[model samples]
Target: MPKFTGYVSDHTKFIEELKSKTPGMEERQQEGRSLLWDKLPISLDEEARTRESRLRQNAYPYQNKF
Candidate 1:
């Protein structure tokens, strides 16, 4: 298996910690879902949507790359 780094590794560890901390199945499932949303590349459409949303929200300064 390939090793994850940076934010991916951090979030993976966070989800594991969350699972260890939570006892209920539903709670773990919810936490897993949240982590999946943050980390997984479920689809290109989802990826594009996330990038577009972040750009619109001005999470980073806009720059023209032309």
Candidate 2:
């Protein structure tokens, strides 16, 4: 088996080209991602309270019994 060295895939090339064309693009992407995805650590009490407050759905929710 031969390993292909110094070979850039099309996807990698596209990303590199995009980054080169747009200055601070990576930083903006990071900021956007952090805004949506980055989160502070949740305390155990908060997590337990959140879990305990959830309402359970009845089985066979479509059918109602009076």
Candidate 3:
């Protein structure tokens, strides 16, 4: 059997230490999510109208230069 080094043991110990240090971490994460990431979905009709529906591309993109 191959003996693994202290990396895995050290990582587990670090995680336990962090959990003990931070209380209510999950609740805080949820509160942050509600404040920042919670949003209503908007229609994409305006986007579709503003952009070209057809795909466009140059055959050789590298040849073009300003």
Candidate 4:
């Protein structure tokens, strides 16, 4: 076997250490990611409305477009 450097070789042990230090760590991580990053699809009508709104911004707002 090669000499062990400071870097970790055992990934499972590392995860165990994290789980032990923080209770409900994995479950909370899943929930937080779902709340912030997970994308649910909007309704087709909502999507069409958004697309229609985008078509209205022809000029930059700084030009005082009415």
Candidate 5:
């Protein structure tokens, strides 16, 4: 009988292969994440300005006021 080694899941194996094939993928992913999600905290004044700059939408927009 052989000593049981650590088991690697199929998904993990695939990811490892993908990383080997594409270098700098992790850096690009980080850059994309920063562009879409990583953001600076906004000040209270900025939040208030953003809230104040929006126009209210009417309910049942398709129906005419007439």
Candidate 6:
């Protein structure tokens, strides 16, 4: 198992700490897709082709849709 940083052992204690340290944190959540279309490198086309080949090599049958 992997452990995440800044996590507490107890849930209640974690919530209390979070509330005191970062008030109104829930109001700042991201609501929709923020485009990164301009940030992609020119080599992205080549990288994507490589990724598609790799995925095709390890393709598995679709078992469910939800």
**Better-scoring candidate (TM-score), 2 or 4:** 2
Local distance difference test, each candidate: 0.73, 0.95, 0.80, 0.85, 0.96, 0.64
RMSD to the hidden true structure, all candidates: 12.5, 2.4, 7.3, 5.2, 4.1, 16.0
Error of 4 at 27 (Å): 2.1
Candidate 4, overall lDDT?
0.85
State which candidate has the highest TM-score.
5
Write the residue-wise lDDT of candidate 5 on 6-63 in tens digits: 9888999999999999999999999999999999999999999999999888998788
Could you estimate the TM-score for every candidate?
0.28, 0.74, 0.37, 0.54, 0.84, 0.27
Q: Which ten residues in a row have the lowest lDDT in candidate 1?
A: 55-64
- Give stretches of model 1 more than 4 Å off: 1-8, 25-66
lDDT of 2 by residue, 30-54 (tens): 9999999999989999999999999
With a 3 Å backbone cut-off (N, CA, C), the pairs that clash in candidate 1 are: none
Candidate 2 total steric clashes: 0
Q: Which residue pairs does candidate 6 place in steric collision?
A: none
How many angstroms is residue 10 displaced in model 6 relative to the true structure, after the best TM-score fit? 1.5
Model 2 per-residue lDDT at 33: 97
Ranking by lDDT: 5, 2, 4, 3, 1, 6
TM-score, prediction 2: 0.74
lDDT of 3 by residue, 1-66 (tens): 977784577789988888789998878889999899897765698667657676777888779667
- Give the Å error, residue 53, model 6: 23
Which model, 5 or 6, shows the larger lDDT? 5
Error of 2 at 3 (Å): 7.2
lDDT of 1: 0.73
For each of the candidates, give the backbone clash count: 0, 0, 0, 0, 0, 0
Q: CA shift at 34, candidate 3, in angstroms?
A: 2.3
When sorted by TM-score, best at the front, the candidate numbers are 5, 2, 4, 3, 1, 6
